[model samples]
Target: MEEKAKSFEELKPMLRPTGVEPGIMKVDPEKCTSCGLCIQNCPFKCLEMDEDEHPKMKSGCVCISCSNCIVACPVDALSIERVYTVKGGFFDTETPAVKMPMPPKDADGTPAEWNEVERVVLERRSVRHYKKKPVPEPLLTRVLEAGRFAPSGGNHQPWKFTVVTDPEFIAELEATLHGFWSGVYPVFNNDETVMNMVGVVETGVFDPRTQYGIRCIALKELPVYLGAPVIVYMGAHTKLNNPALTIGICGQNMNIVANSLGLGACWTNFGAVPLNAMPELKQRLGFGEEWTVVTALVLGYPKFKQFGMVARHYRPVTWFRPGTKTPQTEK
Candidate 1:
């Protein structure tokens, strides 16, 4: 009976949209280089390339509007529509390379300064490989200042940061991180294998947790901090709701600021998994008891720079087009 129950648990259906798994996506064959990126990005295994070097929906598969295929196309060949249809091929909608829309200017023609901000945002990539050089003190301080300037609810600003640069401490941290995950790995997956990861991802049954398990396995081979010289911990311990959002805003500021200064930054919250589970680690870091380690980031010079933009999944969004008479409720 126990084995039967466990088997049933794995067979459960995930509650996403029902009609079509992926909304109608068209691929311009002329533009497609058959890069197979869309196939690589599909979490559900719903896309495959036809013999003629064009992407096609896998046989008898339901489509979801995840937009993974459309966004992964480097050549702007794939597109998606708001409606759900499967008849058209590639000429249905234009799926250009994603870009942040330019915001309108005021009467004085003062353009939004956010163009540069957008460039930094879009260009920012989480770098894992770093050169064996220490980030300059001035640049590091500037990144922290950017983090400190992040806004908080009611202007409370109930956040604190811990910057770790001591080489001995970082080495110990790496060892502790490795030990913690190694022991806890079996709890998530008794049978750790790449095939199991793919199976769990396809079911969408373990959609979020599955990713965590996969990441744990990846971290075992790749150092969680990726040999960076500096780490910044964004933390708070107020008796309020989770400060995850505030810490994220702060960390993002640090990331963009770091990137702008030609330094690479990668967010590594997994470091906290060990710290929170073991109180001694937190104490070692000089943080008070129960201090929620909201985010952890590493900063250093990247070993290799990523030149071109990689396509990302375009999230389905609803835009409100303006009408002559605005709704009274809106104002």
Candidate 2:
């Protein structure tokens, strides 16, 4: 039989010593207004109001050191002190269990050259065209594993990945989304009153750009999901800090891994908005009530080879240094 997952309390005693400092929530009584925002916003429920209405850690409470409570405090009364020593091993080994093969190093054991790594990152393109071949199950698993190791705030790792490889199901999903968009496309061109009514009923505000995209998909002008053989849907808890950004990080990891594995991947928001809107579809696709679809990635072999890095427009950057008279600007 599979072992049952241990609760935090049960695992506390078994925790081993690690040298990393642990963040402990510290509250300044003089600065505190007793607003209880820290307690209310604590994701782990480690904080509770004391008898004096001041926020305090509950008995045997464990903090993940996410510092969410610190951000939630409006009065700047809360801060995280890294005084406590961390207990337990955060990682099993220095190297990842699943990683791409490393390049040969010198006899002195210097770090491997980063040329391959840089090429993977720079040459990866959002492939819109894909070959008809389906991605192998083992390769897909590696892609998912890459995503699983992505960093999240407080190590919450509050994300779920659902993979869809069935051609029939993917076709069904495409049809459903296309139908929904087709039904809603006419409202964009409707008179002001009807459009306003739609905005109120649907998303409170409707962008014409979004409507145009929807129309394109509805009319089959643009491919719904780029005809990729594998689709992975990422969902995260709505209550987590920067959940969408966390999912984006995870998706990028998958994208990079896919590219390294000689596969093409594209991050698409095509399904996210519609998937979340359809409760029945969401349930059918295995997303829980607390979870919201953050993004979707389609993966397959590229139809055509893309070589070299694509040129990107440069943006202005500001740098601050102690000795500098003013901030340095770079373009």
**Predicted structure with the largest TM-score when compared to the true one:** 1
Error of 2 at 225 (Å): 1.4
- lDDT of candidate model 2 versus the reference: 0.70
lDDT of candidates 1 onward, in order? 0.64, 0.70
lDDT per residue (tens digit) for residues 1-331 in model 1: 4543234234322311122323456778889999887775543455787989788776654445455555556777876643333233322233323333345476698875546766777667676667888887899899999988998776666677888988888988888887766655544444333234334433542433333433443456457666889999777766655577877887888899999898988877667645766777787776677577776999998766532244443435545557745433321
- Looking at candidate 2, the ten consecutive residues that score lowest on lDDT are 91-100
Q: Supply every candidate's count of residue pairs whose N, Cα or C atoms clash at under 3 angstroms.
A: 5, 1
Error of 2 at 297 (Å): 0.3
- Cα deviation of 151, candidate 1, in Å: 0.7
Query: What are the per-residue Cα lDDT tens digits for candidate 2 across 92-173?
Result: 1232112233455767988766577777986676666678898899999999999999999899897898999999999898
Q: Model 1 segments beyond 4 Å from truth?
A: 1-114, 191-219, 324-331
Clashing pairs in 2: 16-88
The true-versus-predicted C-alpha distance at residue 156 of model 2, in Å, is 0.8
